[model samples]
Target: MTQKYRNYDPEFKLYVVKLMELDGHKMTDLSQKLDIPYGNLKRWKTEYRDQKKKEEKEAQNQLLTASEYKEMYEKEKKSNVELQEEVDILKKAMHIFNQEK
Candidate 1:
């Protein structure tokens, strides 16, 4: 008699791994309970960890660094000050022109 091999989907594998983690079950115990090989379960656990790390790195890359934010803030502040100065000069000129009329 030959034993049948089982195929598991990615979602199922991740679910099993998460179940083990949440229940704090040992690989040997979980393998016996779920009818899976201990080595396969271990491999799935490792793959999940690597996937999480990759996702975290990608998320970090999407955010701006502290220095970059500071540089942007400084540029906006300078622009605002220059605009205020121009407005002030225009107001003074208008007042002088009105006085001469």
Candidate 2:
């Protein structure tokens, strides 16, 4: 006779890990209560922590540093001033041409 093992989905596995975290439950206690193997619960917790760290690293990568943001703002301000100066010059030239005509 062969024993059948049940497969748990990712969401369920995450939930199980969270239960231990949120409730401060011991792994052995949770394992017995949930009827899951202790080793499986331990592995799930490890994987969840690793995944969260990876996600946090990725998020950090997507964020600009303070210096970077300041530099970008300065560049944009300079570009805006240059554009306004060009517009002013064009307006003066247009006025001068209209007066001559």
Candidate 3:
């Protein structure tokens, strides 16, 4: 007899993890009730938690990048406005000196 293996989809694995979390289901009971191996359930739970942590970390990094870009943009905008004002002042001064000459 050939040993057959069952492949589970991502959705079903996620659902099992959610059931464990939401219902406070014990691993042994869940394994028996769901007709899944205890080791598979444990592995799935670990993978799910790790995946969530990774997603959270990625989100934080993206937010930090966006905020850094915004801060740099604000600084550049302020610097440009100040430089424009200086240029206007210099032009006026030059005009007045030419009129005096």
lDDT of each: 0.92, 0.94, 0.92
lDDT of 2: 0.94
Model 2 lDDT at residue 78: 100
RMSDs, each prediction? Answer: 6.7, 5.5, 9.0
Highest lDDT: which candidate? Answer: 2
User: Which residue pairs does candidate 2 place in steric collision?
Assistant: none
Candidate 1 lDDT tens digits, 30-95: 899989999899999999989989999999998889999999999999999999999999999999
Model 1 spans with C-alpha error above 4 angstroms: 1-3, 70-101
Give the 10-residue window scoring lowest on summed lDDT in candidate 1. 18-27
Give the Å shift of residue 24 in candidate 1: 1.0
In angstroms, the error of model 2 at 93 is: 24
lDDT of 3 at 92: 100
- Order the candidate numbers by TM-score, best to worst: 2, 3, 1
The residue-by-residue lDDT of candidate 3 on 1-101, one tens digit each, is 99668999999998989989888889899899988999999999999899999999989877757788899999999999999999999999999999998
- Candidate 3 at 39: error in angstroms? 0.2
For 12-65, candidate 2 gives per-residue lDDT tens digits of 998999988787889999898989999899999999999999999999999999
> What is candidate 3's CA lDDT for residue 1?
94
Of candidate 3, the 10-residue stretch with the lowest lDDT total is 60-69
